[model samples]
Target: MLDLARIIADELAVKPTQVENALTLFAEGATIPFVARYRKERTGSLDETQLRHISERYDYLTELEDRKKVILETIAQAGKLTEELQAKIEACQQKNELEDLYLPYKPKRRTRATIARERGLEPLADWIKQLNLSKASAALTPEAARYLDPEKGVETVEDALKGAADILAEEIAERTESRAYLRDYFLKQGVFASRIKDDYPEGTTKYEMYRQFSVPVREIAPHNLLALFRGEKEGIINLTLDFDETEVLNYLESREIRTKVPEIRNFYRELIQDGFKRLMQNSLTSEVRSLKKEWADIESIETFEANLRELLLSAPAGMKPTLAIDPGFRTGCKVSVLDETGQFLEYQTIFPHTGDRQKVEAAKTISRLIAQYKIESIAIGNGTAGRETDRFIGDVLKTCDNPPIKVMVNESGASIYSASEVARDEFPDLDLTVRGAISIGRRLQDPLAELVKIDPKSIGVGQYQHDVDQKLLKKKLDDTVESCVNYVGVDLNTASKELLGFVSGLTPTIAKNIIAYRNENGAFKRRKQLLKVAKLGPKTFEQAAGFLRIRGGDNPLDNTAVHPESYAVVEAIAGDLGIPLTEIAKAGDRLKSVQLQKYTSDRVGLPTLRDILKELEKPGRDPRAEFKYATFKEGINEISDLRPGMELEGIVTNVTNFGAFVDIGVHQDGLVHISQLADRFVNDPKEIVKVGQVVKVRVLDVNEQLKRIGLSMRSRDRA
Candidate 1:
């Protein structure tokens, strides 16, 4: 077997030592985020992406080695493992290659070839393969006559020859070289052709775009391929891989036929064609399709991860007294008032859309709540009746002496959160709608914190999220959430268990323990308080201390990302500057001139010292962008209200490979196709836009009947 670390290092373009160190850290129970952030010096400052690549590659290589061992053991038990064969199996780099070499010896279940071998035809097949026909046109029946035995199920020479042909066909199909060549050909030269079923009329099913689609396997987009597979799976379309059969047959014959004898050549030709059509084509087609599907899943999952990361890392509106509203039509709007810390302070029902008298009462209630809570921000859920509710609030605010900043929050997964058990645990007596309102307000305050409680898929920022590999998707999404949560350190005193659970090295049990400790005692006054939590040992503390913040703590550095182990370094710096440790954040000028190399030790290198100095500059500073919101057009409340050539400011709700979907205050979002995403060529939609980005787009067309809105952002297409 190849050196796993060396192979991974070559693949990732990093040093083998870095890969080995990262693997060692992983084996020691360190996470990707922890290793990437804290063990920079040991791994030569490898980032999260490179570390994850190394980790994933290590797992795959380990599994491959285990599979190779099983295959070698099986072959050895069967007395078929030769020196050359053992060498080949040991040197195999891919699982497919190992399986290909093992195909001829793999156990079978009553194949036609197996029946022939059992019926005393194996000797006859061997005779024909070695026969050198002196007469080019000699009939093969004479030679096959010796194998004709009634007791062994071969009744005549013809039956014996047919059985021999079956054996040769299976043998030809199982040839490792032929399989490798054909698999590569199928992937590179095959074309995916899909057509709608006769039962589904043209442009009727949701898969109309794929009704008569044909694309080369290599050039098909990931989303398009996934769509075609889904259509075929749903029985609405017939999908097949089309390739040049004559070319494949020619290649197989050239590889197998080595004689000038026409009779033997003809016999082998017939069996080769039979092997390809009867045995190899279907299996190889499925294998190619499976490979393409895996690739598509990876690309789709990556797109989902990018969008999810952008959504999770979106700017927060900061902690402020907030008024949250879950907009509805007949059910009325559920109103929730939250304090600056996102605690639910009050709840009410306001029927702003009912009668004129009810509207007056709703206006008065909102104004009274604003005055009572001193609401600094108003968060309105962008759901049913959202625009109208925003307009109503706008009217209400017009009369107020000091109006708060009213922003429409995309409450995509608010319903999911409201109905979740976590929400129930937090607010058992509150109505679901009331809980939803609270979620909207909290999301505005801190998106990462609130969104972590809900499933990332339910956040509605992905493409074909439900169709991807659920286990793999969950892992990627969880990793994304964990990375974001740690990137923006969590508040030790007030973070919920869901948010705290994502902290580096913090398990759900430990998060719950931290919450329990805070509840039994008061808020954490120092970062060291976490050591008291049940099951949170020193190792956990070492990994998690830097990413957990405690504001107004006994030590000010606890509020920043500087780890406790590095506290001595900062204290040394403060001592050198002749200043107290509390004033470290204020000594930016002096600290900047201080050589970072002077503070570096064996464990604390330049990379870590620089990070510490940066953290001291902006203690507990958020890495996300500043707060911003799209100002949707006032009158465009529904799809019907939209018109061509109307320029509107919208927020990107989701970014897929094809385009960006922008929410322009209408209930439905409009598509800004990849071609229209920019004036120049845009290879990826993410290159131009991301989730939660406010963009300006002009409406190109609107199909109200289908609820489709076409939009463009190219500067050349200005109205």
Candidate 2:
């Protein structure tokens, strides 16, 4: 049926040829990052996001095709598959539509219709269904009597008519068009009504707002539906749909009953009402609710993915000798010191929040540790007593001659990482909080590297992450992580096994093997040495080598993003320049003299050559932006310290379907609603802001009772 490539192209607003070539490349096993970066010409310069969309849609269509094959095969085997029915099924573009087309032919258990049919009443029902349209008042009484047989359990005309009505109801409900029209009617015109269950207290819970609530079925926001569904599932509310049935009944009557005969028309009315109520209402309500929930899940998952991507791509403070603290109040703050390369050097505890007496001792201990480790930066986990700890550190640093830059780091999944097997292996003797502190320190040094150790779901950036489709959520988040990792090429000499797992074509086993080989034989001197890693064969090397950077390797090209397959071309240019590969780094101007066209071949094209030349010019450049952070306002340590019109500098901790949550050093994050995100209209907050973005937000309002703070970035002057 459909031209899949052309349909996808139209949806994405890309050329059909680009879609076709990208699909072909995908079928041939090329990864999205590879195709987006290396095959620009083939895809008409489609970027990574576009390529990902194409890939996702391609997978969906492929799965849909497989489903179609299964449906057709099963129907054909059932011996009821017709040419027209096959065409109808083939023409369906959606899973719901395809299933609807297969509904009549699907296997059935013993139901009312089946029981009636087995009792030899099919002819009588057919007679009723075909009542003469021209003459209206045709009596179904005589026809019902003919079907009454004592042997078949049709003991009377009334029993016969009842069975006939059940058969008719099932028939009407099974019609594809009937289901389609009614589903649309419900979606557009129906209302979702939820009332507090009888005998339930009014103010007992957060669901009080939904005690007597009604919203348009089509207009209910994702968050509202999720809350409502939770409420219904918890048995606190009685949820149901309300819609005008007159319109639907009229539509069904016009389609199913053509005859105007008064007697038969009366019976048809009863049949239609029974079908709508008994056969269709429950299933259709479930179907409609499921459809809406799917849309909401999609919205929530996309929000999660976007927030996670921003958090993962957050600016790193670079490799600096640092001290990190996972702050606490009563048990004392866990302190971890790390060297420039993130090697754990020491661990201790300091009672910064104990009192004025212990606070002085804590400051002394921090100063000694800083001096001993020569800490270039201090990272404090933004958890319990985080602001108070920061204040203490700032006061202590004020008394020092050479103070390090102290920063607060989001420790969202630091605990998860600390308790993980990876952490246990690395710091077997240390306490969990100490491992968590080390993770926080490493996170500031290189966020992408440290964040990969924890599952994206536990990263605390997702909204309703636990409630979304786990399989779809995992696939999407995995793709996002892989894309981010490859975009930031890993340093071959210093990358941990966990960091390398996301590299293209590299699995966990291969990652571990590479690290093992590194420890045994030292750093990889060139890209070719990757082949020596056990089980990292030619294909794996081909996919992963370009994304792995080996600084100061034997070949200078090894450090850049240029693939190994194109090393010959790079060497040729270096030879033409009459310089060694190491010296080729400074030979950008001299290399312009060579003809790039001469380098193009069947295997390597102009797009790839252009990338090679670009890499040669700025070899080993980082694609990530320069490191930066938000400076939270002083003295705003808790929600109680907040007030309206107080402008503060904060980092966005999470972005959602409705708004972005900004942490203003107040412990609790404030919501920057979509309407207040920008001066202009803002529908998607991701377009205007991202996680970890340092923003100037003015406080719009604060509800101390609810622990809610509303923030605005629209046309407000920064304080």
Candidate 3:
């Protein structure tokens, strides 16, 4: 634990004490949102982002320790455990390092070297190892012939010698220290070079990215390296680790040959070169390159996860009747209405095909919904018939004598949601088209809530999402969903089973049971009521209850992040003073009088107690609403209407390692490249902006032919 704290402190460049304090809060089951918002003084003002980073690193180190235990046990069982080995294993910081130490003991298939050892050539191989053979023929003899059987493929002294060398090579490859040293040396010194395959046809542009590409191991771009390795693996190209052979031989000779007996030195030199070239070189090169690619993938995924969390937490329209149009042509346009709280109200079919009376009826229906239910916004699906529908809605609004209703394009994954089993259960009576409309309407009201029903990939947020590793993409996207769900507290009473399923530590089965319990019993009146739900055990409750908000519950703390188990502590605090637990909500000054130490326990430590006191101050407060809102030009609807230097409001649709894409009143989002993220240099796109964040950006360049808009957040010019 101390070592873990030290590593985190060193990596984050903070004091061990600071890490210890932060970990204490995290261990006590405090949410990152709570710690960053309320316990600022304890964490040295490390924001939620920093706290989350520390928490993740902490979990990784714990995993490393568990792996170390398994490796140590495996080595012990193999009878190879020594005090030195045990100490090294205990101190190991990474999984790769521990696995490297355990490589020799790891079980493997029988190879050529194992077969040679099984034959009576073991003694002969030992004799060869001791021989100081400057000349190869001096050590060669017919007496070494008894073990040299042509039936087993060893026909002569040369064949036996070659077999002995193969044994030596395998032994060298298995040596933990030798492999480690060689891997590091090569990674630091090796240069990666690739050439187009000879049979790829002359002047092929398929691998133009790697044809002339050469970079030092340290300086190579991860994406480029991954692409090249992928090409090579697919037999589309040939790649090599280029290095001067003489220099490599000299380095190995210096390490292996202490005395310069000419014959012995020559033999060792040839042996080292042969062993490296035949066995270690290519294997180690590929391993190191794989490690580099994995590291890059992790970093990219982490960046993506952070951006996705922010985007999912972006503010929703919050319980307003909204008209969602899934724009289309031959299929006609699908329209649906969501009630004040985003529940599906009604849906209808409308066609605006070039010219149709249905278009006018659609306009009248929208206006009626706006008048009847006070619909604040129209969420048009940013898809096929989007532009034409936008024009239709604009024409309708221009002739209206009512409150100006804002029309916004919705990124509709509604069709996917409607087809899902969850949607089927939610709306069994409705058709797929009606469900899609409801999905679009509800998405505008609360994107996070509606989008959680569909798979994130189907939402179309990334570049080359389908091409990447599916398991990796799903894990990353799931992590993003978990982080987002926890970041924005879930409404215990109103949240759908899909939304609740995304909450940290809660699964779909558990979420459904919770909703079932709610439906059977009533709305969850307190966080403790979750215990009554089937399959929702204590551990699941501990992880999820803090992020669930129960409004108008028996205790005000239930409506906030305050855990149910801490109710006694709050009661005790209230008892210490002349007040009731209910009055503690209004007695902010008196609540602060209670010392956290007085209420400390194994589970409810100072960290947890301190958080409980803060929640008492402001119950049911939303952490996200403090952020700014998105506002675009009233009349600007089409991409062609966008001119260079026009300042307009936009919602960040997706954020990548490269940049954040903003949907500025167009079906296609403009790239606010990492360089244009801010006036200053930005290392990560999430640092300056995030997915779903509303930011004012200026049009820097517009390429109509390419259907691309280059935007910048730096300028303020309105053309």
Candidate 4:
């Protein structure tokens, strides 16, 4: 077998030792984030993305090796495994290659080739296969006539030749080289062509653009491919692959037909065409399509991953006293107030949009709640009646001396979170709308903490998320969430179970245990106290302690990202400076000027040392950006009010491959195509905008009936 470590190292462009050490750490139950962050010395300081590639490639290679073993055993038992064949099978690096090599030997149901082989036609087939230009003129009639056997169904010269052709055709189709060539050609040269189905008229369905689409298989965008596949699956489009059949047949004939003799050359030509069309075309086409689908799934998943990361790491409004409103017209708005720690303090229902009398009372209730809670911010859900409610709140704040900072929150998945089991468990006595209100408020307070409670798919920041491979999508989204959660360290004292579960090396069960222990034993005072939690041993602590923050704890280092294993080094650094541990944060320039190389040892390196120093510089500081929000234009509250060339401020709600969707205070998000994102050409919309970014855009066009508002961020006048 090929050396797995060497193969992975070569593929990742790293040393074998690095791959080996990382694998060993992974084998001992270490995670990607932990290995990437903590074990820099052992793994040559490979980052998380590199470490993940190594791990995934290793697993795939191992699976391929196991399959090779199975194929070798099966062929050897069948008495057809020759030394050359064994070598070929063992050298295969892909599943498709191995399967192609084994197709001739694999057991299957009865077919035309099987019946022909059972007759006395094997000798004739072998003779025909060995026919070269030297023997091109040799008469095949005499050799094929000997295979006539009435008992076995070959009753004439033609019957015998037909059976021989069947066997040779199957043999040609099963050739590994032929299948590989066709597979490559199908992927590189074929065209993905589609048209509207008979039942679905043009421009009637969402996939009208794809009705007459034809793109090179290699050049098709991942999003476009996924859309075409979805259209085909929904029976709205008739999709097919277009390629040069004559060219393919010529290539196959060149491999088999080596003679200029018309009889022999023409004979092999007919057989090659029959073999390809009958045995290879459909099968290879499907395989190529599946391979393309996998590629598309990967690209789509990565897009989702990037978007989810930005959304998860969105800047928080900080822990502030907040009033959250889930706005509605007929049902009124459900209001909830939360303290600085995001604990629900009060709830009420207000109807400020129905009547003048109710509006006055509702305004009074809101004002009283703000005064009672000393609210520092107001979070209004961007839903039905959201703009009207924001206007109403602006009016109410006009009379106040110090009004709270009011912002619109994109409440994409708030309702999903409200009705979730996690939500129900937290607020059993409260209504779903009230729970939703609290979520909106908490989202403003800390987006990472509040948004973690809902499924990422429900967040609605992906393109064709539902159409992608569900398993791959879930894994990628989960990994993204975990990465974001760990990137911004969690608060050990106040983090909910859902947020805590994404911590390095912490499972859902262990997260629940930590919360249980915290609830029962009061707040954790030190990072070391986590060892006492049930099912949380030393290893879990080692993996999770660095990412878990305990603010205002007994030890100041506990609040930073310094791992517990490195506390000794920190203490020694403080001792060298003759300052107490509590004053470590105060020694600003001294800490930076300290020689990082002097502290290097077997367990620590410059990377780890630099990280420790940086963490010490900003202990317990958030890695997210400063809080900012977009203020919607007051009068432009509906799509009907939108006009082309009007400039407006908005927040980006979602970013896709082709464009970004901006919530421009019209209750309908507008599309800013990639071409209009900036003055220069843009390859990706993500490079220009993110999920929570505030962008200034000009309305390029508006369709009030269709609720489509085209927007542009270019500096020039709208096109």
Candidate 5:
């Protein structure tokens, strides 16, 4: 096998030393976020993306190497392996190529060729290879007549020749080079077309748009390819591929049939064409589809990951005593009150949307809660009865002594979390809807901390998320959550087990143990106290400590990203400045003025020193952007209220490859297509918007019957 690390380095445009160093750290169990943030010097300052690519590619190569060993061992034990065969297998770079090379020797059930050999036709097949009736031959039949064995089921010379043809066809199908050529040709030239199955009704499904679709394999978009495969799987459509069979037959003949004898050459030519149609076509076509699906899955998973990352890193509404409402029409609204730290204080019921009398009582109840708890903000779920409830609350605050900031929270995954095992454990006795309201409130308090409790898939920010490979989707989403959580360091004293589990090197078990310890022994005073938690050893602490912040701890550096090992360098810097460590916060200018070279040692470099100085300037600062929210236009409560050329303010609910879906005060989301995303040309929707962005758009068209709203940001920006 080639040097896998060196090859990955070339592919990613990084140095070999960087790959080697990163591999060493990965072997030592370093997390991607930790290595990207702290080990910049060792990795040549590679970012999180480069590090993740290295990790994923390295995994692929290692698995490939292991597979090669197994293949070699299996072939050798079968006594079919030769020195040249082993070299060829070892040099194969792609998994598909390796599988193709091994197909001829792979174990199999009884096949036609194998059965023909059993009928004592092997000798006759060898003779056919040498018998080129090119110059002169009495007749091919005369040679074939000698091999007829009636007792062995070969009744005549014709039957014997038929067995020889089957053997030749099998040989042509198994040639590795031919298989590769056909697979490549199918990818480049094949045309995929799907039509409504004859038995199904014409307008029975959402796949009607794809009923007459036809596109070349190479030109199909990733989303369209996935949709076509899904449509075929559901039996709504019959899918077929069109290709030039004559051209394929010609190529196979030129490569396999060299004999000029009109008689023998014609015999081989028939078998060659039969082999392509009967054996090679279907097999290679399936392979090409699988390869395309795998590529499409990768692209879709990446889009999902990018969207989830943006949603998770969205700005928070910060800490405030808040009142949250999960609105409903018939069931009335479920109200939950949260204290400043987001602990559920109380829950109640309100019938704001029921009638005039009920609305009056709802307003009085809301006013009392605001006055009693000193609530600073109100979060209303963006669901049924949401607009009506917001209007009700706005009217009530008009008479109140102090009003709170009202926000319409995207409640996509709140119900999923409320019904989850985590939610049940957090609020065992509360009603499900009440728990959902509490989640909405906490989502406003801190998005990263609260959203971590729910599965990223349930958040509903991805495009074709369910259609992609589940294992890849889960892994990428998990990595995204971890990156976001670590980017905004977790508060050691207040973080839940869900938030702690995503910390670098901290397992779910360790997170539970920390929470248990804190519940029993009180809040952690310093970073060193983590040693008291069960199963948290030196290595775990080393990787996780920098990301865990202990606010108001005894040692001030415990709250910053400075690892425990680098405390000595910090103390030395404080000592040279003639100040106590606590007063180091007042000497930011002096810390910057210090000669960084003088502080470097064998174990510490400029990278480490620079990070330390930067931390000293602002310790434990949140990396998320300041909070902001979109305000929906008043009186636009439903799809019927929208009109062309009406300007509206909306929040982006989901970003996809072709467009961004925005919530413009109607339950139905409006689409801002890529062409209308900006005044200028827009190649990527993500470049102009994200999952939780607040964007202004103009209504282009609204179909009330279809409940579809087409929006345009280009015209709005110019206006």
Candidate 6:
């Protein structure tokens, strides 16, 4: 285990102690968030990503050990378990390396060598391995072929020698040492090369991207490699690894030959070259290339997940009543009003095209709702009738002598969310249209909280999400959600079950039970009160209690991310300093004197203690800072009104692998392609923007017919 920890530390470029500490915490059931946030000092302040990598590597090493055990047992059963072989197996660090060592002894179906062995030619194969080139010419005599059988396909002395050579070739191919040497040589020196098959139809553009491409194994870009392999799998191209055959043959022959006999050297060279070219080269090349591609895909997906998590946790617009409108022509407009806490308050249908009187009535209805609810903002869905509805609402706000209610365009995934089972349960009595409006309003109020209720794919925030591996995408999306939810602590008192379900270590069942208990008993006034909920056991509490916040709890530390189990420790520190926890919250200057090392334990180390001190400095402080207002053009209501180089305020509606979709007071949300994400190269669109981010953009192109408006943030810098 210590050696495994050292290997992991070497791979990750960290101290062995850090890997051991992280593994210990992980083994003790501490989650990534808990270990990352609370055990910083032990791990040298490793972030969540680094800790996850260590955990994953630890699992891989454990699997490697298991494979080693299996290989040793198999070899012992075969009566071939030598001490040298056992030591080699134990020293293997990777799954691939262990498998390579076990390949020769692995059970298999009858092959050419197996057939020869069954034919009683094992003696001849052994003689060939010792290959006496001094008498090579004499050994090929007819009497030397007495064991050869014509029916078994060995016709003469020459045929027998050829058959024995074939057996030798197969044996060499299976040798663990030979395979390892070849694998390492290929990894360090091989080059990937591809070309369109000449036999393919002439002038075909299907494989144009890969018509001629070459890159060393180490230098190939992951995305390009994935694209090339995908094209090849789709039959649009062909790929191969390029290597110097003569050089490889020399390397293999050098290992097999020790004497300076000219005949022996020539024979060995011919044998090794034939074996590699005919049996091993192509197969090994393909296998290695596939493995490299898999590694690249894993890295790419990890990067994508990181970028997505950051985007999902971006700053929200905060809780405030918002007038949501899903505009449409034939069905009129769906409007809803939400209270300051994002609850559905009222709903109304507004039609602007029926006539001027209908338009006036719709305007009056909107004005009344805005006045009645004191709506802080208006959120318009960026769809077919969105521009018309925005214009109508703007005109109404202008005519009224009320506070200027900012009109913001929202993404159109709320309809999908509203029709979902989750939305139905939340608003059972409300119509789908009204629920959709409520979703829009809540999204504008706090995107992170509301968006969590909807499936990320349905939210239309990803590029090629439907085309990617569904299981992989879902796992990544779930991880992103958990990371986001944990990053912004959940309010235990007021958070909905949907939001609570995403909190770290809390399952959907526990989240539902917590809500049920709150409904039956009343609002929880302290962190300890969670224990009263059914199935809210000690283990779950240990994991989740820290992230669940109670704003006005009996103990101020309960409002922070400090766990209840650590209350005694905090009290001790406070007592030693001669101050109360509440007083420390008010003025944390005295906390500087509390020595964290004195409170360290096997479970709660100096790392966790320091975190507690930091939390006490500002209890219940929001990770997201203050919100800022976004400014939109006064009269612009449609994409047609947009001109090149004109700056406009836009809300990011959907973020995808390629780019982000922004609504600029236009009925259609324009795409800001990933290439135009910034002046520098943007690998993912989510890195630079996210869903519901209010960004300033400049119009690059406006297509009225197609309703496509090209937007850019690059010019926003100049403005």
Tens digits of lDDT, candidate 2, 1-719: 67889889999998999999999988877888888877777898899899988888888887888899999999999998999999998877788888888888888898898999999888888878767344545677887898888998999999999899989889999999999999999999999999988768878877998999999999988888888888888889889988888998998888888777777788888989989889888888899999998998989888988888888888789899999999999999999999998999988899988888998899999999989989889999998889988898999999888999999999999999999999998899999999999999999999999999999998899987876789989988999899999988999889989989999889999999999999999988999999999999887888888999988877788899999888998888788779988788798677667688988887788888888888888888877788887777788899999889888999999988789999899888899998889888877888999898999999999999889999999886432
TM-scores for every predicted model:
0.98, 0.95, 0.81, 0.98, 0.96, 0.83
* Better TM-score candidate (3, 5): 5
Per-residue lDDT of candidate 6, residues 1-719 (tens digit): 22988888888898999999999988887788877776677798888878878877787788887878888989999998999888888988767777877877899888767777766677786765666433344333444478778887766776665666667777777777777777777777888888787767656655676788888887776666777777777777788888888888877787776546565566566777778888789778877886786666565565556545645565566777788887778788888887777777778899986789999899888888878888778887766776667677777888877654555545546778889899888889988888887887776677778878888767655544443466767876787788788888988877888899988678899999999999998889987888888898787787888899887778888888887878888888888887776787755576877768888776677767878878888777778645554555767876667889888887776665557778776667888877787888887665798665788887889889768888888855542
Which clashing pairs does model 2 show? 136-261
lDDT of all predictions: 0.92, 0.88, 0.74, 0.92, 0.89, 0.76
Model 1: per-residue Cα lDDT over 577-633, one tens digit each: 998999989997898998887888888998888888999999989989999998887
Report clashes for each candidate as comma-separated counts.
0, 1, 2, 0, 0, 0
Writing each residue's lDDT as its tens digit, candidate 5 over 88-154 gives 9998778999898888888888877888889988888777876642345546688788888889888
At residue 292, give the lDDT of candidate 1: 94
lDDT of 3 by residue, 1-719 (tens): 23888889898888888788899987786656556644556777776567877988898889988888788888889898999888888888877777878877777788767777765566776666656432343434554665778777778877776666667657666667767877787678778888887677756646776876688787675556667767887788788777666776676666655544565556566777887787778777878877777766666566556655665776676667677788778888877877777777767777776466767777787677667766677777767767677778777777767654554545646678889998889989988877887787776677788888888777766544543566787877886786677766899888998899887668889998988999999887878888889998887787787789987788777777776666777788888887877777898787777877877776566766776777788876666654344555656767788899888888887777778889877667899988888877888677887676788888999898769999988745322
What's the lDDT of the predicted structure labeled candidate 4?
A: 0.92
Candidate 4 clashes between residue pairs 3 or more apart in a chain or in different chains: none
Worst 10 residues of 5 by lDDT: 130-139
Give the range of the ten consecutive residues with the poorest summed lDDT in model 4: 129-138
Which stretches in model 4 have alpha-carbon errors above 4 Å? 717-719
Consecutive 10-residue window with the lowest summed lDDT within model 3:
132-141
Model 5 alpha-carbon miss at residue 269, Å:
2.5
